[model samples]
Target: MSWVILIVSGVLEAVWATALGKSEGFTKLWPTVILGVALVASMGGLALAMRDISTGTAYAVWVGIGAALTVAYAMIFGGEPTSIVKVLLLLGLVGCVVGLKLVDTSH
Candidate 1:
């Protein structure tokens, strides 16, 4: 399913984002490689999903999922500060992503 691929790509967006951070401006070899691979895969998946989903909806959902997961990952394991407001905002983003899915008219 395109939606499934889109979701996976969204998660990969988080993976590539985290890898890019670890790449340290591409100074690190392994992290840089990971970033390259994840970036391509994520973009490819997004393109595939776009075949079925509207461009705007797909892009918004993809970005929303990626952003929420990225912040969550940073807060949980990267020693980033966490707060109730941050959590609530992330939840709101997720809710909006789901709402987009629910209202999508195209299959």
Candidate 2:
């Protein structure tokens, strides 16, 4: 359950990241609001998960998931250039994140 919460928080990190980009320095009302909400929720979830998971492992997994999803979202919708190399890198990030989960000893 902690892992599940952590994963969701990671995804929310992506949401907040995207929202922040869309906020145009917080000038946009909706995106700014979304960013605030998502940011708080994501952090809250991360804190909750940290109660069960080691801090280092939880943080690494959270960051890994967020970073991978953020780049993927940008490539797909934010006019970011996409290439074979970028796709491969994202795959690698995901692989590393999965590796962390598999090797976690606190379960």
Top candidate (TM-score): 1
Per-candidate clashes come to 0, 0
Candidate 1 lDDT for residue 61:
94
Model 2: colliding residue pairs: none
- The residue pairs found clashing in candidate 1 are none
How high is each candidate's TM-score? 0.99, 0.97
The CA lDDT at 15 in model 1 is: 93
Give the per-residue lDDT of model 1 (tens digit) for 16-97. 9999999999999999999999999999999999999999999999999999999999999999899999999999999999
Off by over 4 Å in 2: none
Write model 2 residue lDDT over 1-98, tens digit each, in one string. Answer: 99999999999999999999999999999999999999999999999999988999899999999999999999999999999999999999889988
**Model 2 C-alpha lDDT versus the unseen true structure:** 0.94
Computed on alpha carbons, the lDDT of every model, listed in order, comes to 0.97, 0.94
Q: How far is candidate 1 from the true structure (C-alpha RMSD, Å)?
A: 0.5
User: Lowest summed lDDT over 10 consecutive residues: which window, candidate 2?
Assistant: 98-107
